[model samples]
Every structure is written in C-alpha cells, then in structure tokens.
Target: MDIDVFAATHAQEWKRLDELVRRRRSLAGEEVDELVDLYQRVSTHLSVVRSAGQDPNLVARLSALVARARSAVTGAHSSSWSEVSGFFTRTFPGTLYRLRWWWIGASAGTLLVAFLAGAWVVLDPEVLNAMQTPEAMRQYVEHDFANYYAENPGTSFSAQVWTNNAWVAAQAIVFGVFLALPTIAVLAMNGAGIGSSAGMMIVHGRGEEFFSLILPHGFLELTAVFVAGGVGLKLGWTIIEPGDRPRLRALGEEARAAMAVALGLVVVLFVSGLVEGLVTGNMVRGRIATPVGLGIGFFVEVLFLAYVYTVGKRAYRKGETGDIRNTPEAVPVAG
Candidate 1:
C-alpha cells in the first residue's frame, strides 16, 4: 500500500512498457508480446496504487504510460486513403459482381416494362389522353422536354440531378428492408415515367430527339437505379429465405452490403448527373454535337460495365463479400 515502494517495485516494468511503446513500429514478435505483458502488469500496478490513495505524480506517470501502451497494443486504424481505395477496388465491385444476377434481372425487367408501356401508350390514344391533354402533351414533347435540360446552369443542374438520383437510388436500396415491395414500386414507377415520355415523343415524331437526349445520360443513370433495386430486392428476399444462415444474420449481412452499394451509387449517379447536365444539356443548347455527346455517354456506360465485371469479378473471386471487413459476429445463442 506504500506509494513509494509500489512505484519503485514497478518502475522497471513501466520503463520497459514505455520503451516498447516508443518502438512499437519496429517491434520484434517476442518484444511485442513482452510489451503486452508489461502493459498488463503496469495497468494492475496503477489500479492498485489508485486504490491505495497513492502518489499523484506516480499516478499521472502510469496513466500516460498506460495510454501509450494501449495505443501501441491496438495499433493505428487503417488510413482514410486505404479505406477508400479498398472500397472501390474490393468492396464495391465485389458486391456488384456477387449480386450481378439480381441487378441484371432488374435491368431486364425494368426495360421490358418500359418498352411495353411505351408501346401501349403509342397504340392507345386514350392512354395518352389519360396522362395529359393534347395541348399539354404537345408542349411537353416539343419544348418542355428539351428545355428541361438547358434551363439551368450546367454545374447547378448537375448538382440537382445528382442529388435527386442519389436519393432515389438510396431509397431503392434502403427500402429493401420492407420485403422489396417499395423497391419494386420504385423501379416500376421509374420505368413507367420513362416509357410515358418516350411514347409521347415518339407519337409526335420526335423519337430521335428523345433518345438523343436520354441516351447520353439515361444509360448510366438507369443502370445505377437497377443496381439499387436489385440490391434492395435481395435484402428483402433475405427476410423471406435466409438459406443456411439465421434470418436476422442474413438480413444484417445483406443490409450492410446494401449500404456499400448505396455509397458506390453516389459516385455512379454523380457521373450520370454530369453527363445529363453537361453533355445532354449542351447537346440541346447546340454547344456539342449530338453524335459526340452520344459517344461520350456510351463510352462511360461501357467503361462502368467493364469495371464492374473485371474488378468486381476478381474481387468476388477472392472472397470479398462487399460487407465491412472484420465486423464482429453476433454471439451464438442456443435455441
């Protein structure tokens, strides 16, 4: 209980702990183990000294030593740059590749719905009328549709488009927890909107114009949406049939993966927004040629798909699951 005796007895161990902490980066395996052992012993000494109402100076010294030792033992976290790099190279693409089928199916289904809706709207004058009056529809096809892109400054317009599309994609992924109905509805509504617009334009003999504007941005934007919808549905399906894992555990895994997809889509949608605002809008304003704009959009879309298949497939093959690394497993409970 004597403060002086306690300090003297543990002085060597404390000094060793300090030395180890100072040289943590260069520590040998045995020295690392010794540092950990000293850390534990010194921690106990500090606790005992405090219990005995010991010397304030000794207490302060031990406190500092223990803090440094703790840091040394735990080591520093991965750098922010490392984390960002890992997410893009491993986590994001791996998730995309792993869930490729789900999103691909989503893309196919949504496109099919859009095509059918467009055809129906073209064939059924009543359907077209139900959507809008003839005058309003004509105005939309000739002016409103084309003008929407060039109405705002390119930077501000890109920001707005990015925000809106990102929110929609986030909704599609986050709402997957509700058994995917919301995700399905989002996809359906999006497809229907596109189809209606296309149908209206085509019927007015402006199909080329519609595509000229839409294709420059729509390819990537729609793909990002399809990815979100697919991931969302997968999350919901986990609730329905979790396979070999516990239902809650499966849901947790999928939910985390869904979050990664959401974050990745932010970057994806930003690029799409840039295309819409800069390339598509410029095309309308006669700032860029139609073929050049279309080529730029197509190149971006192809590059993205190629990145997903190559980087994503490689990462997935290496056992990357797109979930956060080293997440603590849930405690096992006996049924």
Candidate 2:
C-alpha cells in the first residue's frame, strides 16, 4: 500500500475515532488515553515521512504506522459498540472473561451453599414445620396477602412498580459490594426456609397440597432468588479475583456489572410477587387455571434465562474490550 494513501485513510479514521471517543461512553478516559498514545506515535511517523521526502523505507514505515493506527481505530470502534450494547442489554458475564472463573465459581458456590443449607432443613422435619406453623400460613394467606396490596394499590401500575423496584434494586445493588458473606447468608436462610417447609409438609402428610400450592409461583420465585444470588456470588469473586488490577479497581468494575444484574432481578421479583399474590391466592388449581398460566410463566422464565445466557456472554466480551464498569440478597433458590 502507498504510504500516503494509507496515512490518508487512517487519518480519516483517527479523526472519526476522536469524535466517537467524545460521544461514546464506553470509550471513556482510559480508551482515549490509548488512542492519544497511538496518535502521538502516528504524528511522529508523519513527521518522519515529511522529512524523508518519499524515501522507500520512510514510505514503508509510514504505511506500517497507518496500518497500526487503522487497526487500533477499528478495534476501538468495535469494542465501544460492544460495551454500549452490553450496557443497554445488561450483559456482564461474557464481557469479563478474565473474571469468568470467578463468576462461574462464585455462582456455583452460592448455589451449592443454598442447596446444602436447604438440605439441612429438609432433613429436619421439625424445623420445617416450625417455620410454616399453621398460624403462620393462615396469616400469610389472609392478612399478609391482603395487607400487602393495601399497602400498595399502585404497584400494578408501571411507574410505581418501577419506583419501588428501584429502591429494592438499590439495596440489592449496594449490598452486593460486600459480596461473599452477605450472599452466602441470604442463600442459606432462604434455602433452609424452603427445605424445612417442604420437609415439614411431607412429614405432616400435606405434601400433595404443598406441591399444588407452591408449584405455580414457587418455580418463578425460587428462580429469581438463585439469579440474584448468582449476581452476589459474581460480586464476591470480584473481591477475590480482581485480576492483575488493584483490588479496588476490580471490585468497582465487577460491582457495576453486579448492580445492573441485581436491579434487573428486583424487577423480576415484583412480577413473581404479583403472581404469588394474585394467582397463588386462588390455590384451587381449577379456579386459577393453573396449567396454562403456570406453563406460560415457566416458559417465559426458561426463555428469559436462555436469552440472558446467550446475549450476556456476547455483550460481556464487548464490555471488557470497551471497558464498562457496571447483586442480590436471596430470600430463596429458584425451584
């Protein structure tokens, strides 16, 4: 390639990159730092080319510089777009590949924690029955169910729901920063509660009724908790595996991503709550039309998780390249 032609092409790209760096949030300070560093090098090459007055070696060097600059610009643009998309879509897992081992490990660890905790409760029928005392179940079904809606008639509306969701989301997000201890605690408490309740019901020979009452909303509710716990686990591992970077820096980066996930989970919990409150109320399967409704809800959750798995991985890679620093207490594991 002609050095002059190559330089001209890349000069346009360099200028465009400058414009993009200013406009795009993903290409923040650090990315711009790299671009400026390359720009300085390019400028020096340009100066050499000018002084050399068309020497073949100078032209060749200039061409090499142009290629490098062009490649950098291309990489920057691709990375920035990837980060931007991931941010909008809330895709973190794939973006932080360096931290992948941590994410997966923490997630799996949290779930195991939950399962183990639940196992203890399940093994102890007495503990299971204690939490779900007849009076407690009655109160939950009658007063608590009605009182919750009385406390928030506006929850059915979008804005109010989002506002309430944002508040809980913030709690989950901020609380996510501490990571391991908090998440482990949440998983244990919730998991144990479920397991004990199940064991108790089975012991009391109310197992069939319990399954029927729980199967509809419990599935969604439990899944939400597991997802939230997974976010917390990811955040915890950020503390453990902050990479070669400073621990604080790695924590900040992973925290942002975890916060986004936790926020999303809060929204999911609201939907699950609504279903439990409204649909679960008519415990009579026939009245609530359990089969079709539960089927749809189950399908939606499955599809949603699948989408998260695919899109999140792709977006995470993009975010890491673009550098976007983006949690949860669980009440239960997903059924």
- TM-scores of the models, in the order given: 0.78, 0.54
Model 2 TM-score on a 0 to 1 scale? 0.54
| Every model: Cα RMSD to truth | 10.8, 14.1
Model 1 compared with the native: what TM-score? 0.78
- Model 2, 107-159: lDDT tens digits are 46545654565566567656555666778866654456334433443335334
**Which candidate's lDDT is highest?**
1
| List of clashing residue pairs for candidate 1 | none
lDDT of 1 at 254: 80
lDDT of 1 by residue, 1-335 (tens): 45677678777888788888999999999999999898877777766654443354555566678777877888856678998999999999999999999999889989988999999999999998899888898889889999999999999999999999999999999889999999999999899889988998999999999999999999999999999999999999988998976576567668878989999999999999999999999999999999999999999999999999999999999989976464223332222
Off by over 4 Å in 1: 1-76, 327-335
lDDT of 2 at 160: 53
lDDT of each: 0.87, 0.53
